[model samples]
Target: MYTTLLENIPMLFNDPTRDFVAGIIDAEGNLQILKKGSIRLVVVNTNVTILSAVRRVLADIGIEIAIRPYGKPKGNERQRYRVVIYGRGNVEKVLKVIPLQHPKFFSIPLFSSPSWGRKSGNERDPRPQLLPPPPGGGHIGGTAAV
Candidate 1:
């Protein structure tokens, strides 16, 4: 079943090129909206082949990305390769292509950019909502401070 799927994966998307790029981001990727209203799309995996494929696809489509090592993962840990894309232009490129749909369908509107966000206010709010999600209100891993 896996082999058959692998063989047919390439055919899954062509016209909707964003779907293909999104597949990578969804699989081992993180699309984050930072505090400064910038987009941080991170794709990490042990498989170099797929990472390279992502690079090729994004490059051909004019969204540039840099493939980098995913940092030292402690002793005896498997190192992963990563492809990261930043900034509004790049995120805009992606959002324009596919509307940032897929991965997990959440409350973010299709017309709205999944990566678009507002910068943090310099002055501390007198009363800020404690339980509210992050600026973009999306899935974020690791420790985050409010």
Candidate 2:
């Protein structure tokens, strides 16, 4: 497939790849931060080509990852694969540029703006809470507050 051509090709972890990865994450992946538990950045899909590309690209940068392929999708669903990366060290590196979409929980305070917590949020405005330094002394993101 398309990914096979990349096998022998040298893929660099440059801006191009970062943008592609970010697009993929924004559309099909997520930034997961478990409350006082664990944090991980992952992308799952039924297409293996994209995931393979991700694996190879990250590998080029010396960041290792294991691609888990589901045995079966059951019923009429298509088989899928999950590209998972854990550990704060690796997650932070990816979080730097990988734009996360839904299912992403921030470690900062619930509401940066008091008005934001009103009975009804701005239905049209879908932007998440702006990231600001926590009162406990931490960076914008919840890397330490958690």
Candidate with top lDDT is 1
List candidate 1 stretches off by more than 4 Å: 1-3, 6-19, 98-106, 109-146
Q: List the residue pairs that clash in candidate 1.
A: none
TM-score of 2: 0.54
Clashing pairs in model 2?
Answer: none
lDDT of 1 by residue, 1-146 (tens): 99997776666443325566677676566556555444556778877767777777788778778788877878887888888777646754654564445444334342233334334755433221222225654444331321
Q: Give candidate 2 misplaced runs (Cα > 4 Å).
A: 1-16, 34-36, 99-146
lDDT of 2 at 15: 26
All-Cα superposition RMSD per candidate: 9.6, 11.1
lDDT of 2 at 146: 35
Alpha-carbon lDDT, every model:
0.58, 0.57
lDDT (Cα, tens digit) per residue for candidate 2, span 19-65: 56666665666544555445466678887777777776667566788
